[model samples]
Target: MYLTSKVVIEKEKIKKPRGLQNTLHDDYVKCKEECRKIEEREITEKYIQYLKTELEAAELVVAQESAALQATSIVSSNNQNENKLDQVPSEDSILKSEKETFVQEENLIV
Candidate 1:
């Protein structure tokens, strides 16, 4: 009878620690899962913020390029107009040349 009681007490002691270990393991797993979820959320938010920044930068570059193209176009158009004006002669020069040629022809005939 004494040996049987001692064995029973030992079994109870062993069972108690096993139960406590199972509970601790379950709690550890829950904590790890929560940490993983938080990390994933943080990483996703950072990526979203990065993408927004990149989009804004791209838009700015595009706007700058568009403005440069427009300025170049205006400058080129002005230069072309200036060139055309440079090639054209004034009206007074044509009349002076014609009068000189007519007088020369009259002197030749005389």
Candidate 2:
């Protein structure tokens, strides 16, 4: 789906062959092969570019979803923490109850 190498595509050397000579069939065949190679490289480069763009869009969607998930988790955790705080007694109330228990224990000892 995407390019594996950091460098996208290697540039092919543009061959500037002179006008085709029709004396021999071999020369014509060679020219056709060269043209085919040029077309192949052109299409290959365009396909690679298309793949790169699709990959970029996919990455962006993944990033956005990940951020949304993290935000939801954070808000859920904060809500849990707030609920815990509400359920727990204050420090001063805990201390006052402990002192009253201590006094009762002391009287019972006496």
Model 1 TM-score is 0.62
lDDT of each: 0.92, 0.85
- Candidate 2: residue 81 lDDT (0-100): 94
lDDT of 2 by residue, 21-99 (tens): 3446667788899999999999999999999999999999999999999999999999999998889798999999999
Give the per-residue lDDT of model 1 (tens digit) for 47-72: 99999999999999999999999999
TM value for model 2: 0.53
Model 2 lDDT vs. the true structure?
Answer: 0.85
Number of the predicted model whose lDDT against the real structure is largest? 1
The TM-score leader among the candidates is: 1
Q: List the residue pairs that clash in candidate 1.
A: none
